[model samples]
Target: MDKLEEITSDGVAVCQPGLRLGQLESEARKKGWELRMYPSTLVKASVGGFLAGGSGGIGSVAHGGLRDFDTVRAFEVVTMEKKPRVVLHEGPAVHEILHAWGTNGILTRIWFALTPAVEWMQLTAAFSTYEEAFQFAESIATGNTWTKRLATVFEWPIPSFFTPIKRLVRADKSLVLIMIAASQADALHAAAIAAGGEVTFTGAFDGPRTQPLLSDYTWNHTTLWAMKADPAYTYLQCGFSLTECREQFRKLRERYGQEILFHIEFMKNGDGVVIPGAIPLVRFSTEERLNDMIAFCRSIGVFVANPHVNYLEDGGRFRPDNIQLLAKQRYDPRGLLNPGKMISFRKQVVTK
Candidate 1:
C-alpha cells in the first residue's frame, strides 16, 4: 500500500498508484476530505489504471476528466528501459502517458487533488418524454443551487433493466438519475416539477427500501445492463457540445427511433458549459451497420470515442497520439511494456 502520506491543510492527498480509489476515498472520509473526482468504476479501478486510461466518470460533470492538467498534480512512473528507471513526471509531462492505455510506462504513485466530502442523495425522476428528462438533468447540472456528482438521462426501456429499482420506475417513462448534495434535495424536486417531470425516487443507497447505488446505472455500466439483457447489443461513447448534442439527439431519435435507446451523462465542457456524453444503446445488427452509424455521427460533427476497439489510436481520439508515441520512445526504449497497444509504436518497430 502506498503510504497515505501528507494530506495538506487543503485536501490534496499523494498516494501510490496501486491504491484503489474506493479505499483512498474511505480513508479520506475519515479525515473529512474526499477525492474531488473519480470514475463510476471507483470500486475496482486503481489510481494508476484510471490515470492511464484517462477515463471520465461520475464526478466528471463537475470536475472534468483526468486529461485536465490539474486533475493529477504529479506521477512517479517506471520506464521499461533496460535497467528500468523510476522517473517523476509533473504538470504537462503527465499528459504524455495519460490515456496511453499503459503502453509506455508503469505508473507507481500519484499526487491527487482532493476536496471536502459531502453527503449525497441518490435520486431519480421520470418524464413523459426523453427531452423533458434530459432538460431536467441539464437544469440540475447547470443549476447554481446544487452540487451534482452525477446527472444521467435514460430513455424509457433502459430503466427497466435496472431490476433493483424496477418497483420505483414505471414502464414507459423516460428517466433522470442523479446524485446531488443532500442540501439541494428541495431544489432538485422543484426543478423536476418545473421541467414537467415527477420526482420518483429520493433517498439514500441503503435506505429502508435499498437499491444499488445510482452511479452503478450510469456511464458504461448502463451498457452492461443492456448487454446482460441481450448479448447482441453493443454501445458507443460519443461527446457533443451542449448545443449540438440536443439537435443530434433529436435527429437520431427521429431516424433510428426505438432502434437506438437514448442515454446521456451530462457534464461541463472545458468552457464550463453543459455538454452530453452520450452512450446510446444500439440494436446490434451487424458490424458494418455499427461502423455506418459511427460514420454517420462523425459526418454530422459528433465526436465518437469508439469503445469497441482495443488499440489506443483507434479509440477516443481516432488516431495515433503523437505525444504518447514520443513518450513511449523516450521511456520504453525496448518496447517491452504493454506491447502492441500503441499502433504508432508497432509501426516504429516495423520500420526499424
Candidate 2:
C-alpha cells in the first residue's frame, strides 16, 4: 500500500512480481482504481519490466494471457511536459505501454480491469513420446472449453544407440508436464483424452509446486550433476507453441545434439497470438553452452526477447496493446530503449 501510494503521489515507474498482484488489485478495487499485473516472480524481476514486456503466467492456458488481464485500465505515467500525467486510456493506449519494454513513456502506476477469481482444478498429462505428447498439446490449444491451466510436452531421450546415432534417442525425451487449472477438471480430462494426452496427475501439485524443491534457481540444473551415470542433467528454457514445440525438439537434437533433460511445462497462450502460449522451458544445465543453446532456440523461431520475458510464459502479466504503442510514440520516438527490444515501429512517431 505504501509503495502504491508513493507512486500515486509522485507518479514514477513501479514494478512488482505476481505474488503481490493481489495487493495491487485489492488496492485498486478499494479505491475504485485499477492496475496492470505481471504474473510471475519478483525474485529477480521488476514490476514495469515484466508486464511492460508481455509476460503471462501459470494460469494463462485457461484464464487467458497477461495482455488479456491488461486489456482495460488507467495508467499513472510520467510525461514529456516535465510533469506527471494520469491517463484514463484503454485498448490502444494500454498497448502503447504494455510490453514495449519501457521504450514508451515510463509507467509509474497501472490499473487493470479485475478478473473474477475462481476455484482452480489443477492437472497434468505425461506421454511416452514427443509425438504423443505434442498431439495432446495441439488439441488443447484449439479446444473450446475454458477449463485448462497449461498444456506442456516433456522428453527423455535414450542413450546414444550406435555410439554415433544420427537422430536423438528416445531416452532423451524425459518428463515434461502440461500443467493446467480449470473450472471443470472433468472437462479438461475429456479434452485431454480427445487430444491424445495422458493424464499425469490432477490437483494438489504433488512434490514441489515450483519444481526442483527450490524457490529461486531456474534454467538448466545440469551444471553440477554426478558424472557417474548422473541420471540428472541441466535444463534450458524455451518459449514455443504446440506447433513450434515439435520443430524445436527437432532443432535441439539437430543443432546441439543434446537431448531433453527432463521437464518442459507447456501452457496455453490464452489467445495464442504473437507470444503464443507462454511456454515454460527447463533445461538441466547452465554450463559453457548457454550462448549456443540460446542461439539454437532463436534460429528455430522462438522469440528470445528478454530472460524475464519468459517469466510471463508461466503466467505473469503486462499492459494491453494500444497503450504500449502510444507510450512508444511519445517517449521513445527513436526506439532506442533497448534497441531491438520490444517496440518495433518508432520512425512513424518521428514522421508525425
Candidate 3:
C-alpha cells in the first residue's frame, strides 16, 4: 500500500515486497491493469526488483505472471535537453526507456491499471493412499472445478511419519487433499468428499470475522517443507493444466524415483501468473524433500529465478543484461545521474 500510495502521490518512485493478495489484483484488473510481485507483495519487494528481475509469488497464477500485467501509460524520463535531457515519450519509443537493461533512463514512477481482487476459500481432505490423494488433487484442479483459487493437494509417502497429527491423516496410504472455494464451503466440501477424499477444514475463528481464504492467504510453506527434500533445497515455478501437470508429474516421480521428492501447489490461472504457497507459512521437516527440487525443476523445464541461478554470475555479478543495458546508460549522451547496475546475467533474458 505504501508503494501504491507513493506512485499515486508522485513522490515515491517504486515497489514489490510480499505475496500479493488476489483481492488486491482483482480490484486492479477491473481497471485493465495488474502487477505481478515476486516473493510477494506481502514481503513487500520493490517494483524495481520486480521489473529488473522477473520474480513472482502467490499472486502470479491468475495475473498473467509478471510482464503481462504492466501496460505502462507514460514515462517521466530525462530527455537530452541542454543540461536536462528528459523526454515524455509515446508509442514503442518508450522501449528506449524501459527494459533498457537498466541504463537508458531511471524509472522513477509509472501509471498503470488495476485488476479485480479474487475472493477465495481454502479446503482440504486427507486420504490413505498416494493414488487417492493425487487423484482428488488432479480431479479438482482438472476443469477449474473451483473458482478463484486452486486445489492444493499433497501425498505423504510415509504417512506414519506424521504420527497422531499424521495419524489424523490415514496410515500408510493417506493422501492430503486441499482446495479453495469462493464462498460455498458446504457445496465445495461436498464436492471434494464425493470425489473420494476425507475432508477437513484447517482454519477456525480466533478473533473476529474476515473473508476466509482470500483475506489471509498462505500456500508456499506446505510445498517447501513437503516438496523441498532438504532445507538447503530450492524450487521453481511452472504453468501446466492438471492433465499436463500430471503427465509430467508422473514422469518426474518415476524417472527421478527416490532421488527427487515431488509435490505440487494448485492455484487458479486466468490472466495472472502466481506462486501459490500454502496459506500461512508453516514449517515442517522438509530437508529431505528439497535436495532434489532443483534438479527436478531442470528436468521439467520450470525456470527457477531465485538470487542464485540468475544474479551473481555475470563477469563478477554474472549478469549480461547489465552489459547490454550499459550502451544506453544515459538519457543524455553524457552520463550525469547515477546509472543502473552494470554487470552481466547468466540466464536467458526474455522480452515482453
Candidate 4:
C-alpha cells in the first residue's frame, strides 16, 4: 500500500511491489497515464504478483507480457541467502525472477513502463455464430483505424453465464467483448456492422453500470463465469496462430462438440501480429481425459499452455528456463523462498 511514486509525464511509474494494480492505475489516471500492461484481476493483483507469476491480461495485445522485458524496467529483490542482500536488477536481468513464481527472490519494488491513458469504453457486439464473432474480433484486433485494449469472442450460449447482464446478451447470438478508445467508437461500430455483427452494448466503466466490468467477463474470467453456471467444468490455455486458427477451431468443436465451449481472446504476438488464443471451457471428466485433450490439441499444432498443473514450467513451456535457473542460484541459494515451484531448482539439487 505504501510507495506510491510519481508518474512521469512519459508514463513511467516506480512503486513498492505491494501496491494494488487498480490503485496504481487510478492514481495514474489522474495524471492521464496508465500501466502499459495489466491482468484482468487488476483490483486484486499486486505489482509483485503480476511480475513474479508472469501474467498477461488486457493490454497484452499491445505490450506483451511481464516477461517482455520492456514492460518491467527494474526489480528490487531481497535475496533468500544466509546473508540476505538487496539486489537491484535492470533490463532483461530482471527476467531471472520475473516469472520464477517467487521461488528465486522476494520482489520488494518494481518500475513499470506506462502509456497514455485513454477513455476506454466497454462494447459488446453480437454475431449470428461463433465463427463470425471470431472473424470480427480478429479484424478489430488487427485493424489500424481503431485501437483496442481487449477483444474477446465467446461461443454461443456462453454469454448466458453473465446473469447480471442477461438482458444484454441474446440466447442465439455469440458475443464479442471489446474495450476501445472512446474516440474510435463510431469506427469500431462501423467495422462491427460491416463484419455482420450488432453493437449491443457500449459505455464507460463508470457510466451507469449495473453489471460487472466488461473485462471481468473476458480473459480467464470467461472460464469463471462458466464454472459458476455449471460446476462441472475446467479450462485450457492454448494459442492458435492465424494460419491454424480456423482449421483447429473447427476440428476441436467437432471433436468435443458441446462438451467444450470455445472462447477466444485475440492478442498480438511478440512481433505485433494478431493471433487468436483459446481458453476452452471443458466439461470435466477425469485427469486422464484432460491430459489426452492437451495432447490432441498440441498434435494439431496448437500451443497449449497447460493450466491444470501448479509448477511454473508445467504450466507454461514444460521445460526449465535457464534464466530463472541462474537467478535462483544467485538469489535463493538455500531455496527457502516459495519452495517446490521451480522444477529446475529441485533437479539441480538432486544432481548435486
Candidate 5:
C-alpha cells in the first residue's frame, strides 16, 4: 500500500494512502515536484492519516491547508459495510472525508496536487523581544516578494527547550524560524536585519540534512519539545484574527505572562488571507485554571481550538460540518468507523 503509483504529466501524485509523507516528498522531489503542504510529522505521518486528521503544517504559509480545495485532488475510498463498495471522490467532494478522522470512510488511494520544487533554506532569526520576532514573521507571511514555506515565532523561554539548536539560540532572545526559497535568502536576511533581528542560523533545507530538520521545531512539534523538557506543559491551538493578531498577542502576553509560552505559525486561511495560528504551551496548574484560560482567550476574540478535548467537534471545528455528517451517513451508516470520536454521529442517531 505504501506505493507512489504515478506522477501525472500535469504534476499530480497518485499514491497509496499508506505511503509516508516523507517518502512521498522524496519521490516527488526526484520528479522535480513537491506536495503543497504537509504536517510537521512528515517522516511518520501516512497520507491516509494526514488526510483524515491533519489541518495544516510546513507549506501552509503559501498553500493554505490540506482542507483547502486545491491541496487534494481526489480520494479513493472503501465503504465499511459487508461487501464494501469502492468509491472515488473528486474535486470539492473530497472534503467530506478530509479531516473527518477516519469516521467517514477508509481511504485506499489519493491524488495530491503538486508544484514545481524549489530549493528551500532553513534559518532562524533572533530578536531582542518576542514582539519584534512576531512582527518579522508576519512580514514574511504577508509579503509577496519572497516565496516561503514556514514562518514560526518562539517566545523567549520556548527557545530554551530546543536543546539541539542551543548553540544558535540565545537564552534571552525570542526566535523566528523560517523556510524560504533559497533564491530569497539574501532578501530575507536583509529584511531580518532591517527589522532589528539577527540571522542566527541558516542552512540548506533539502537533500542530506541534519538529524533534526528545523521543521521539527515548528507546529505541534514546538509543544512536543516543551513537553519533553517539562511534562507539566500542555498546549492550545489558537487562531488569531489577522487584522487583530498584533493586539491579541499583546493581550495574551499581558494576561498569561510566563504561564503560557507563545508560539506562532503564520499561514494562509482557505480564502488565501494570511492569519496567525498559535500552538501556545500552557503551564499546567489546575483544570479550573486551564478552562479559565480558554474562556479568557474566547473573550478576547481569539479562536481557541481546544486541544485538550478528544471529541472531533470539541477540538478544532467546534461543530461537525453538515457535509461530513451526510457523508458519514452514506459511507459508514452503522457508525462503525472510529466510534465515539464524532459526537454528532451519536446525536444524529438519537434524533433519528
Candidate 6:
C-alpha cells in the first residue's frame, strides 16, 4: 500500500495513503516535482494520516494549507459497511474526508497536486530582538523578493531548546528559520541585513541529509523540542489576524512574558494573503491556567485551536463543516469509525 504508483507529466502524484510523506516527496523530487504541502512530521506521518489529522506545514508559506491550495485532486476512501465499498471522490468532494480524523471513511489512495521542484536552501537568521526576527520573516512571507517554502520565527529562549543547531545560534538572540530558493540566497542575505538580522546558518536541503534540517525545528516540532528540554512545557495552536498580528504578539508577550514561548509560522491563508499561525510553548502549571490562557487568547481575537480537548468540535479552530458530518452519515452510518471523536455524530444520533 505504501507505493508511489504514478507521477504524471502534469505534476500529479497518484499514491497509496500508507506511503510516508517524506518518501513521497523524495520520489516526487526524483521526478522533478514535490508535494504542495506537508506536516513537519513528514518522515513518520503517512499520507492518509496527514490528510486526516494535519492542517499544514513546510511549503504552506507559499502554497497555503492542504485545504486552501486545491492540493488534493482526489481521494479513494473505503466505507465501513456490511460489504465495504471503494469510493472515489474528486475535486471539491475530497474535503469530505480531509482533516476529519478518519471518522468518516478510511483512505486507500490519494491523488496529490504537486509543484515543480526547487533546490531549497535551509537558512537561519538571528536578530537582536524578537520584533526584528518577526519583521524579517514577515518581509519574506509578504514580499515577492524571495520565494520560500518555510518561514518560522522563535522568540529568545525558544531557540535555546533547539540543541542540535545550538552552536550555530546565539543563546540570547531570537531566530527566524527558513527554507528558501537557492537562487534567492543573495537577495535573502541583503533582506536579513536590512531587517537588522544576520543569516547565521545556510545549507542545501536536498532530502534526507546527514546534517540536521532547519525544518525539524519548526511547526509543532518546536514544541516537541521544548517539551524534550523541559517536560513542564505544553503548546497552544493559534492563529492571529494578518493585519493585527504584530499588536497581538505584543499583547501576548506582555501577558505571559517568558512563560509562553512565542513560535510563529508565517503562511498564506485561503485567500492567498499571508497570516501568522502560532504553536506557542506554554509552561504548564495547571489545566486551569492553560484553559484561562486559551480563553484570554480568544478574547483578544487570537483564534485558539484548543488541542487540550479531545472532541473534534472543541479542538478545531473553525466551526464543524457540514460536509464532514454528511460524509460521516453516508460512509459510516453506524458511527463505528473512530468512535466518540466526532461530537456531531452523537448529536445527530440523539436528535433521531
Top lDDT hit? 5
Clashes of each: 0, 82, 88, 0, 0, 0
Quickly count the clashes in candidate 5.
Answer: 0
Across 56-90, the per-residue lDDT of candidate 5 in tens digits comes to: 89989899988774779998999876568999999
lDDT over C-alpha atoms for residue 106 of model 6 = 95
- Residue 277 lDDT (model 5): 86
Ordered by TM-score, highest first, the candidates read 6, 5, 4, 1, 3, 2
TM-scores for candidates 1 onward, in order: 0.93, 0.55, 0.56, 0.94, 0.95, 0.95
Candidate 2, which segments miss by more than 4 Å at Cα? 1-19, 22-38, 42-49, 62-64, 68-72, 80-89, 100-106, 157-183, 187-200, 204-245, 259-303, 306-352
lDDT of 2 by residue, 256-333 (tens): 554443234334443543223322333435544655666667777764443533322222223433444456566656
How much is the lDDT of residue 95 in candidate 6?
83
lDDT of 1: 0.79
User: Candidate 2: minimum summed lDDT over ten consecutive residues — where?
Assistant: 213-222
For all the candidates, what are their Cα RMSDs to the real structure? 2.8, 9.6, 8.6, 2.6, 2.3, 2.2
Span of ten consecutive residues with least summed lDDT in model 1? 204-213
lDDT of each: 0.79, 0.45, 0.42, 0.80, 0.87, 0.87
Residue runs of model 5 more than 4 Å from their true location after superposition: 207-212, 318-321, 347-352
Candidate 2 local distance difference test against the native: 0.45
Backbone clashes counted, model 2: 82
| lDDT minimum window of 10 residues, candidate 4 | 203-212
Residue 303 miss distance in model 2 (angstroms): 4.2
Which tens-of-lDDT digit does each residue in 166-274 have in candidate 6? 8768879999998889999877888888888877888888884427777788899888999899999999999888888888877888988777888999888889888
